[model samples]
Target chain A: MKKLQIIALIFSILFAIIIVQSCKSTSNITESKFGAQLWGENCIRCHNTPSPETFSDTEWDVAVMHMRVRANLTESEAVKIADFLKTAN
Target chain B: MAFGQLYKITKEISNQVNIHKMKNLIILILSFFLILLMNQNVKAQDIQSTDEIQKLKQEIELLSKQNNSYKPGKSQFLLRGYAHSGLQTNNNGFSFVGGSFNPLLIYKQSDRLLFETELEMELVGSAVELGIEYANISYLLSKNITIRAGKMLVPFGIFVPNLHPAWINKFPTAPLGAGHEGILPTNDIGVEIRGGSYLGNLKVNYSFFAVNGGQLNDGMEEPEEAGIIHHGIFPDNNNGKTIGSRIGIFPFSNSSMELGFSAMYGKTGARESDVEDIKALHYAFDISYVKTLSSMSSVLDLKAQYTGVNVSDANYPEHDDPDELYTFDNKSKTWFAQLSLRPALVENPIVRNLEFAIRYSDLLTPEGAEWHVNQSQTDVGINYWFDWRTVVKFSYRIRSGFEGGHSEEPSHGGVEEDGGNSFFIHWAIGF
Candidate 1:
């Protein structure tokens, strides 16, 4: 139907926009640096920033992974955040 | 001739030849001996090299072995949740009520999969009423996609899943129709696909789901409850598939703003019960902005959402008169806007921990339904943060509405303004 086609077209346009912007992003940079920035911006989205020392390194792995699903963080972003947490902790 | 001399000379010649031969033989013998000695020396050096390598390998083994006490376990378990107890005073009287604790269990089966659930237990009268608010298993299908199955908070808006916790909610109560009895359903049984990504600097998240959605309570338990949507986890004989989606966009680099859109569609009537096919459609728009202003030394947080539901015209039995049926344009809408400010960076610790919030909410339902409501409510509150996950909130609410709207139809006289006022004090903590 025409409605379905229009919906598909809108989604395609949105996907194209995302791809174009992703190409311009600094995604190629080191994850540690990106993770550091992500941590500074994201953890406060719902609650306060958790202290790095509050959890063990292994505990952070589970905690951050949970947040990945709960907060809807990207896989790379989760891993990078995990890496930074471990290093900081 | 001198024969004896000649013989002596010949003998001398022979002896000289023999001496030359002996000299060559002795040189050959000495060379052979020197080569043998060099071979022995090389063998000795080889043995020493082999001994040193053996020693090095032993040291390497010793250093390679360690306790390894801190490596990740095969599985992980964490207990997390929030608890709150509150008392409210109305125009009539005050009662110590609404005490509840939500215990969450998270089992990380692996890095790629997890199981979690929350038990919402509340104290009502003298009994503890408990319910499983959500229970689901999630598998990380890929870096950008996650597949989940079980009871989940319907992602119609950000509030239900992300900010309903008492510690995070600025006010003591839910915004006007956003609560359990609100137009929106809290959660449902379903399968969902959800994920998030960074579209350049702009962040995005989305959820798509299929659920066995709400059923119309036509066999009204109460005369007023007719036409109400009962969203329990039960199978509908209609067998219609209910599908929904929510997409959230955050445009700021600081992730301080999010705009969301949502929609859901399905049939609400049960076919086995011989009810006519009735369809329902729902839409919602929500926005949230939370920003820390450096110059002002304060944080400004704002949230707003508008939700609308429309169901096809359907007849429902009147509880008072069993044979009689009624129908109405089944439509409902609800909206709430809340803003809060916190001086988090103030020099004084006590003052910095304080927050002020105000919310305005409005709602409207079908004019014919007993549960119909036409009114708006305003709430103002002050909250003090004990820590990041603990808070004490004091809120006052004023609800004003058109008389005879939610309960019944007005008489010959046009509806008059009606409402109520209440105050609440609550303490919430998360662990």
Candidate 2:
């Protein structure tokens, strides 16, 4: 069906972008503390930034994981954000 | 006499020698005793010094323990909220509304326990109303599982829990059937277990809950006036319980694509009642995809959901009123799709963040229902983000096919049967 084709096309493009981005040297990207920066940048886009101490380290792990999928963050970016949140409290 | 004098002289000389020797021996013994006393004093001083050092060491250990006991990130409480104000214009006229001020309270008890509550106050014309949206307590059982209890937002779909925030909603209003007055149950008193895990390159999340079943109103005068099946707000007269679950999958590690499904089932009748117990079943499917174009500094978000509800044996008694003869349908369905594009991915000094979005929704009720049960709406909006948690939105909505003709004023905002169009400009902020 045409709908299937459109969906496939979208995924293909997304996968292509991921492949390209992954090929680049990420040494410079990981050097900066992406955790705190990404947390402020992405988490607040939808709702207020909850105080870091609002959830414990274990709770933050789950919360950040949920948001990562809900908000569309890369795995590395999600992990970094999760790390900062767990320690920030 | 000469011999006795010589003997006495010799004896006297011997006595003098003996006396001198005895005196020398006594002095030597005294000197030895003085040395022993000196040694005893030095040993006592040494013992005292050792005891003082031991006391100082114990004090240092106590201070160290106190310093370690002061945890930097312990339990805490916080208050945060959001407010919305806007103007809406329809066929009737323009009205100014001071929409709602919702305050949320969050308490973190420990690494394992948390509590959250939200109170919503809204102004309708000159009247004010207050309600509790959600109040729940959660305890983490492990790294991947949590147990939650209390009044919570129903986990039937993604819209209520994820996108209902005023600042986050793509449009000014919710899609048909998903709003406060929607047919779908938006909140429930219940307990749930939720968690997430990763499988290879994919991620998985799930929630399972049990709650009081919906209330059934069976004493209505007419079939069309059926009152049963109020979404689980109050204590259930029936002995039935509702069970629900939702599962989601993220297939790719690099891509933000989520696919989810949810289902709930329960009975809505009292035990051994005149009316046959109604069997209620509901299910929903939802998906979301987000893509960021680094070259263009743009982001695209797509989200959609489809929900359906079915009630079995909902036939009602016929009444003398002619208009009430129609039987309510056993099934209803609703769905919405939304797309949003944010052009300013990078923070621009002046332009900041700008986003455009469009959404379409449809709600279908059981055929032959007395009221207007079929509804559809389209919304197009533009959002200007002053900051991450604050936004100004301009939206135009075209709504049709609403039920009307009730004498009583509507509890929540409901349009007339002949639906009208409206333009709304609302400012939303979270703090």
Candidate 3:
């Protein structure tokens, strides 16, 4: 019985060590992940870091048009921006 | 070996935990600094926006002040016209008085330059005429000298060339053509030099004129024989030249208590009624006193005038008799007196215009003549000023003159029983 207890204890220790290592590696990866593609290039210019659901589609439409003039958007770009605004909110 | 390995692993785990806590502390501090920086940045942005709004408000105020400086100065335009239609009933028959339309247009280019013209229907059709009632661009030459050119009213007596019955006095029996004799042609279409200087508390105006004479009519274009000639006075434009002067004194601004006197002498044009153009000479003199008394109750105006004319008859070349006294060479004197009042009425809030007035005048023919025919005229009128440039007027007039003794022969004298009454209503709008 004593021998069995010792073996079980060794296995459990190994598992715990593996779990810690994986958790550390995953957290580091999350921190380094680039949000620039989702935010900086598109959303961050008009919106803060808040959720998109904060504004309604109509509100977003007005906000986007107001910014579009300054952004110098072409017709197609403006349409795309409107579509993005509607869906974002 | 197993024990040593276990210790080393545990020790590494402990160090990792410590490092995680330190990382969290660093993140908290950095986040606090970021929040402070963001709050400061937002405050600065708000201040900048406020400054921009104030600057915009100031710019708007400056633009409004610049708009009010481009408006025009003192200017005047005149539109004068009369339209009349009358129905008369009498024991003999019912007659419809012919309607007449007299239209006059006048424009003032400045304080001095004036151009005027008048057109009216006459027995022979339309009589169209134009004259420079007053033309010399006046320069405040001095405190005393006022030199003028371009036609002017011959400063003689109380009447000027343009003083027609349709304008100043609309009394039917008011010795119509008596005021303007061949004596002092009221208008001399010539140049004049004048001076209006103040002496102490008195104001004086003196003017001299050289003019073209021989322009006269009884406010009507019908044949001279068709209308009753007041005091046997007819305009004989047969005059060629005339010189005259006027002197006046004003005691106060509200009251023009003045005495104006003037005289003129000139050669006259031939009479259209006669075949031959004869040599004619004329002399005229006039004097008048005008006073205005203002009281809290009402305002009153009193005026009187006397005029005399001497003319050499054109048809009867050998005779120097004035038309009034055909027997003993030609000479006539016509005179009149008038009083007027304006009773203050309710003040209008919407239109703060001036009040209305009522006036009466008694005009007589040649004085001391066998005929003592005179006119009784009374008028009640209202005047409203919309602005400095526009005015509207309504008036009613009652006159008794044409019905009196208006026999062609002076010896017959006038019959008061034959006199008739006339009533008229007038509306005038002008700018």
Candidate 1 lDDT tens digits, B384-423: 9988788998988888885333432110011111246778
What is the TM-score of chain A, computed separately for every candidate?
0.64, 0.67, 0.41
Error of 1 at B32 (Å): 42
Compared to the true structure, candidate 3 yields what TM-score? 0.48
lDDT of 1 at B351: 93
DockQ of each: 0.30, 0.07, 0.00
Descending-lDDT candidate ranking: 1, 2, 3
Worst 10 residues of 1 chain B by lDDT: B409-418
Tell me the tens digit of each residue's lDDT in model 3 across B1-431. Answer: 99999999999999999899899999999999999999999999999999999999898877766655543333444555443333334343454434334555544444334344444442222332332233333332332444455544455555443123232332222333333222234444566655443343344445656666543222123222111222112343544555555555555432235555555545443356442232223333333333223443433444455655554442322213234322223354445455544332225543334435454544444332233345655656555544322334344445566322233211001111123333333222211
Largest TM-score belongs to which candidate?
Answer: 1
lDDT for every model? Answer: 0.77, 0.68, 0.41
Residue by residue across A1-89, what tens digits does model 3's lDDT show? 35334534543453344323322222222223233322223232211223446446544444333223222222233345556546766
Fnat across every predicted model, in order:
0.41, 0.06, 0.00
| Candidate achieving higher lDDT, 1 or 3 | 1
Query: Deviation in angstroms for B268 in model 2?
Result: 1.7
- Identify the candidate with maximal lDDT: 1
Candidate 2 wrongly placed segments (more than 4 Å) = A1-82, A85-89, B1-73, B219-228, B319-328, B346-352, B402-418
lDDT of 2 by residue, B170-251 (tens): 7668887776756677788989876554443455566778888676555454344363356746876667788877766776
CAPRI rating of model 1: acceptable
